[model samples]
Target: MNMKWYEVAKIRMKELDINQEKLAEHLDMTKGAISHWLNARREPSLDDIAKIMKYLGFSEFVVNHDGTISTAGGNENVSNLIPYKPGKEYPVLSSVQAGCWAEAIEAYTLDEISEWLESDAHIQGDAFWLKVEGDSMTAPTGQSVPEGNYVLFDTAKEAMNGSLVIAKLTDSNEATFKKLIIDAGQKYLKGLNPAWPMVPVNGNCKIIGVAVEAKMRFL
Candidate 1:
């Protein structure tokens, strides 16, 4: 019989010589929440599962074409496991170019791009990297993406409530990055910083893509 996800997690935790408290600390979650997840009282979201797997020292997990997950670095038979492949490389675009991304992509070939970055994130459709310019998205506490970091955006991903997105406003020539918030039937673009005012998503505002990942540069 196949082991359940929680069972696998428990076994891994035992091998690593850590209890739920330690695991929760590493994940930045409360111990009660971790307990609920491990006890199977609640289900973890896809994002939470990814974080747990990553913190447990699993390098990668493969989703088979048939929709089955294959855990890497396991004792399972290897013949049927899919081959591991390196992450895809995506082009880095300027804020102005990203504002008119559809047109820019059509105009320039991949070879014409001067810089490219690799990401292991599972993304769909066209994707690109954009360097953050200001402190609008930087927060004083909790989740934050500071200025000067590179954010990866996927055009095919659906932008949901609380998603980070790249957007183009009718009044601006450059694209803006912010957290997307949906309340009732209305949408708003919120800056993570408390001092920054939120912007309403009007007819003149266009969502470009959802941000999938962010990377910080040392130099």
Candidate 2:
């Protein structure tokens, strides 16, 4: 998917070795205004985005009617090189039709990815983002994962008892986010909500990844 204008601006800044302070200076705008736009506290008009793009030295920026933005034609010229920070970026999988992403970590294509999530865990493994579809993981009292949140997971981390994980039953192609439980050497998939029943891990169960972070946004 095409990124929003601010995301493209962030990539441009990184390419040009310019910090937000320098970007504000180049745009002749207050740092606070720039910060607001970056943090999604406010949005810039199309004209403002154009000006920011020009100052970032992009050859051209195409804004679609749907508000997505992309750049073309200009090379990213970095005069000051910063140390490369190796962070794990996970692709957001949108559907089970895309196949089992957890089964083949390196085979995911750009088109299958809905968005990207950068993980701070920095573990020596891959990661992915799963969008919570229902309130099955919402607990009545503590640590509820409400519906419509995003969960970031580490593929290398083992899912222990009581650990929340992304899992799929052997017979099913779809992946699910839920708490994992092991009892008497039998594994089960569990929901935090009291109304949901604990499901046995029938056939073959695949543990994709362990939950590392959960994000919820309101507007």
Candidate 3:
């Protein structure tokens, strides 16, 4: 069962022994805004929800895809709140095929997926998954993405400067993951590993997607 944000807010207030006015005052928010949130007239942003949950002494809060609130910390049982809808599934592409991921994904049928992965959260936009294939982006400084980890890219999001992105050269048949760097009026795909050569994003280069999140699977 999904609980609305307002219901969760009321329950948390009761559990914390605080009144609505006190909560509104403590959060430095207007009473009407708080009331609006409580009455489901206005939805709070994720940041606002996090602030409210933290103020209420919750350490973990998940904004579920189905517009529900799930809390965990102390004595709260989060298992009941998880929707467990298998989340959003994405296509896992190989290094060679990842270069043309934008085009290749359209040709794939859902039934043909044996090597696919699922998102644990509701990610906005068309997303795709890729397994780290090489150590080109792996560095010894312990800040690099390790090989075999799964990276989720949102094609709908524009690649911003300093964002990790999957890019491919127009003439190449493979895709590579690196930090997108723009310095001195030049764009370059910079890898974490010092051993790997930096590749310039000329007119022949195409960005696939901005890497949003990565997951590690032990099984």
Candidate 4:
């Protein structure tokens, strides 16, 4: 049989330079439990699997009825990073932390990127990328900002009262995409979907970064 899911996770984790102990913290499990998982002596529960998917950035890899995974296009850009070396920590933000449409979650770089842009607006601070997972912000006319896109972040930009932002509900750590409204007493995180009236995405949601630019694939 192909390597078990746990084993596969172990391999990917190592490739990302993340250790078992660190991954255990993300999974809310003990070190020994992570060991058992890697050894295939233990298995994660359904809820655990979902959390692991989020931690591993595999939210779109659908789980089949047979317990097999279907590798989809969800993690298309997980391979673009140049790999981290010593003395580097990328800012890890949550999606719905920054976006007009696509929310950002994590920064994928080790150093400050102030020199990579064509202008001053491209100066990257403590910001990064979070893979987009939904289409609630898709505009019928703006297919250019396709759903499931990645937005580059800049943590330095102050979140203004009415800017579109990535936010999370304190009740839910999972990130979301929405418009940000600072209404004196209560901040409202507006959703583009009229079906679901805009709520406070900033009040509870963590602000990961302000979007500098969005990256998506046309292919």
Candidate 5:
């Protein structure tokens, strides 16, 4: 038998950057079993072929053209957009602290982020994982932000004057997640709690990224 069914498996595995061994793991199979199909020493059963096609997001119908059979879907015409799923984990590597954060920490990602005003419709930006620290901005928002709310940072966005943001202070080797205040020739980091003082900023405060969203896991 030609046993060309393995061709479909090979194509999907290469296209997705997934290996046969990994695919077998995803399908809860032994490596030796998958090795047999790849080596063509033994043909994959109908059940195995069905599982492979489904995992590749292809329909069950295999089109017949001469001796060549093709899968219904060949990973074409798909939007190729990753659907946003909140609470899903993503890597957190600090671009600033290159040495310290080079090893990307496994962090959970948030699906969507809301503006400071709590309007659900105003959200716009790409999701990034960030670590929040310090107590500088405590006047209005940092209370909920907490000391370590793995923030979902995004700068491709818009906000009001008093909205909270994660900004980097050039002079000091640190970034402050504080409320934004832009005035005539003066920029300051506003604190949420009135008791805390609002620190003045200079041309050094770089808006690295805004704290657009967050993921807090309470154990």
Candidate 6:
């Protein structure tokens, strides 16, 4: 009989002398959550499973081409072992479309979308992709999101201090991308480039979503 993904992970952890607490620490998750997953009390998301496999120094849990996850070993037939579904495909919206996303999303169907991109991250609620437009987010050092890249935004995520977000100004119809900063209870939209000026967030500013991932394409 083929071992389950969690069972394999448990064996690997024992060999590596890593306990549940240590694995949780390495994965930046809670020990209780890790315990639940390993004990079969709860199922982990596909992304979490991937993270666990990565930290365990193997990639036995693999995503098949048909969007099913399976456990693989030498000379073993691939089979769907995980009960969870695959990651979702989100529409790639233009800046203008993203600016009016709330209204636009309701008006169009998934088939109407020109382009859609898939992500491996476990997302809650609705999500979308927006291409980077300008150099305002480009910085000389530290974390930088350069122009001509794609950013995946999660609408359900709360906008926290120092989070990259897509914002809309009530005074204007277009959406803008910037880093969110909260200073002394006051919020501000700041660009990564030092030369760019920071825009104060007030009644007119609305945070559309928090950026979850950034990807670059070379063709």
List the global CA lDDT of all models.
0.71, 0.68, 0.68, 0.53, 0.53, 0.72
What residue pairs are clashing in model 2? none
Q: Give a tens-digit lDDT track for model 4, residues 115-137.
A: 22111123346655554555555
Best by lDDT, which number? 6
Candidate 6: regions farther than 4 A off = 1-51, 54-86, 96-107
Per-candidate TM-scores read 0.59, 0.52, 0.58, 0.41, 0.42, 0.61
Residues 19-72 of candidate 5: C-alpha lDDT, one tens digit per residue: 665577567888898888667788676678677666665554452432234435
Q: What tens digits encode model 2's per-residue C-alpha lDDT throughout 1-219?
A: 666667776876766456776577557799999999877689788888788776665545576666566544322332211224444577876522111223323325877665786643434367777667767787889978887777777789878999898876566565777788999989988788888888888567788788867767573
Error of 3 at 130 (Å): 0.9
TM-score-wise, the better of 3 and 5 is 3
Candidate 5 deviant stretches above 4 angstroms: 1-90, 94-126, 137-143
Q: What's model 6's lDDT at 121?
A: 53
Segments in model 1 whose C-alpha atoms lie over 4 Å from true places: 1-85, 95-107
Off by over 4 Å in 4: 1-121, 141-145, 170-172, 201-203
Candidate 2 yields a Cα-based lDDT of 0.68
